[model samples]
Target: MEFTFLFSQFMSGLTYGLMLFLVASGLSLIFGVMNILNFAHATLWLIGAYICFTFWSLMEAHQFALWVSIPLAALATAATGWVCEVVLIKRIYKRELHEQLLITYAMALIFGDLIKIVWGPTDRLIVRPSIIQKPLFLFGAPIDSYFIFVILIGVAVAVGLWWFLKYTKYGHIVKAAVYSREMVGALGIPIPKIYTWVFTLGIFIAGLAGGVQSAIGSVTLGMDMNIIIQAFCVVVIGGFGSLMGTLVGSLIVGEVFSFAILYWPDGAMVLIFVITAMILIVKPWGLFGTPLRA
Candidate 1:
């Protein structure tokens, strides 16, 4: 590919990577602290998009829709997570990994179909804000303002997470609990409540990610499936429980798929899996994960 072509591809890759990070961060967080594989995570994103579309359609202005849908979507996703935790995931924490995976996968299928029942099988689009519809020049290339927003939001989330983990008291508590759950519980910390909050927060992030994505393109019923597989690849490549790993893995996968499609349209999906398989063989715990702990 020519330099210009490669540059544009790289920019596209960055946008894709940021979107993946938005989804993967929530997955990583829940898995990191709770030790559960949440299959319904991507469905939450789809739910958020649908919720955004519903609100946007009801209220015609892009600004009004954007303002209302984000928090509403987040709240809806959080409530769903809380209910799922109470009704299902919490009970299966001590079960086999395969069992938890099976249950969550079932939940994903159920939730996805439920969304279809509510929103129908058609795709729905969000009206992008006027400001985001304009392109910004970067390095002699025009970039979508919406993509810039994704990158900025992702970076801000990363920084905020880092700061929360490093400086906040509750964050330290969570870290302690992650390392020594028994000891943290013994010290009078409400581990159950903490798990609930963490789980809810993760689901909310997934919802926010989806709501944001609605602005870029149409939200289809099957978008969850498309995103979940890539999110899973990111989780695997980054390791199940590592935040930084998720971020890096997302970028790698995003770039690989973007460039692969540019050169070999049919092989794009396979390339990342091939790379991930090779990496797992070399370093099973992922690039940033702690092998023994995870």
Candidate 2:
């Protein structure tokens, strides 16, 4: 019985960690390729959730509403990300770091307000499909069926991203840009266009994460604020631009938080910070990240 309980907790932590990976992977990719820190990333994610909810609500009578809405929300959010990159982010490429930070931070506030205007203050809930409505037993442990789906999606995404980064031409370009954007530009690659597509791809992943999250719980205002901080932590711990690092860091955080809550509920967050602090002290560049060029 005790083993079963522990297994369930471990599974829960894994689920949470993968969810963090989904959000943080895009964040890491953008920062790695463009050297841009996007404060509005989570807000865009929230928009994706709301968009999914709206789409699902429109076709609530159909059992297939949710399956269709998730991808649609992702595409819509990707479009928004593309526009923001071209209109606002493009102007800041050569600006000072402080200027870039200020712009992205302001965008976050603006996007947050836009969300309120469009979705109002009411919390939105997704009516899950009948297929995932019940619990599944695994070795005498009852697990949420939806969680199994979440786990599978997370694993699939992780594997898919790894394959893309390892085998594709654009992936090689992205990797090279990460090491030295100047070199990539010198090679005649359009840096600005690459930046735009990378940003859009990052936002698309975030949107997919958001759409998945909406089915997990009620989508409420200010949720982005919470997740964004954690997402940053994930990037920092995993090492910005290192996909495997992000995955490892996310699992560490998720597992620590899950188990810590059971033993020390009030200190779970503090414990996470403590661990993060330790990692930063030992390796400023993060566990998997290489030092930045001077």
Candidate 3:
């Protein structure tokens, strides 16, 4: 019985960690490729959740409402990301670091307000489709069926990204651009265009994660605040631009938080920070990250 209980907790932690990976992977990708820290990424994710809710609400009578809404929300969010990149982010590419940070931070505030105005103060909930409405038992442990789906999505995204980076021409360009944007530009690649697409792609993943999250529970205002901080921690721990590191870091955080909550509910968050601090002290650039060039 005790083993079963522990297994359940482990599964819960794994689910939470994969969710973090979904959010942080895009974040890491954007920062790795563009050197831009997007303060509004989580806001964009929330926007995706809201968009999915809207779409699902519109077709609530149908069985396929949610399945269709997720991708639509992702595309819509990607479009918004593209607009931000073209109109605002593009202008800041060569600006001072503080200037870039200020603009993204401002964007976060603006987007947050927009979410309130559009969605109102009401919390949105997505009713699970009949298929995932019940729990599944694994070795005497009951697990939410939806959680399995989330895990699959996380794994798929990870493998898809790996294949893209390892096998595709554009992926190679993206990787090269990460190390030497100027050199890639000199070789005739359109650096600005790459930046635009990469930013859009990152937000698209965030949006997809959001859509998935909407089905997990109520979508409320200010939800992004909590997740954004954690997402940043995931990126920092995993090392920016390292997909494998992001996966491992997310699991570490998720499991640590899950188990810690059982033993020390009040200190769960503090413990996470303590671990982060230790990692930073030992390796300033992170476990998988290379040192920045002078």
Give the backbone clash total of model 3: 0
Write down the RMSD of all candidates, one decimal each.
1.7, 1.1, 1.0
lDDT of 1 by residue, 91-205 (tens): 8878888999999999999998899899998878777767777887777677777787788878887788778778999888877877888899999998888888888888988
Question: What is the alpha-carbon lDDT for the whole of candidate 2?
Answer: 0.91
Better of 2 and 3 by lDDT: 3
What's the TM for model 2?
Answer: 0.97
Which regions of candidate 3 deviate over 4 angstroms? Answer: none
- Local distance difference test scores for all models: 0.84, 0.91, 0.92
Model 2 alpha-carbon drift over 4 Å, by segment: none
TM-score of each: 0.94, 0.97, 0.98
- Give one digit per residue, the lDDT tens place, for model 3 in 212-241: 899989999999998888888887788888
Candidate 2 lDDT over residue span 225-283, tens digit each: 97888888887787889999999999999999889989999998888888888999999
Q: Write out the backbone clash pairs for model 1.
A: none
Clash numbers, per candidate: 0, 0, 0
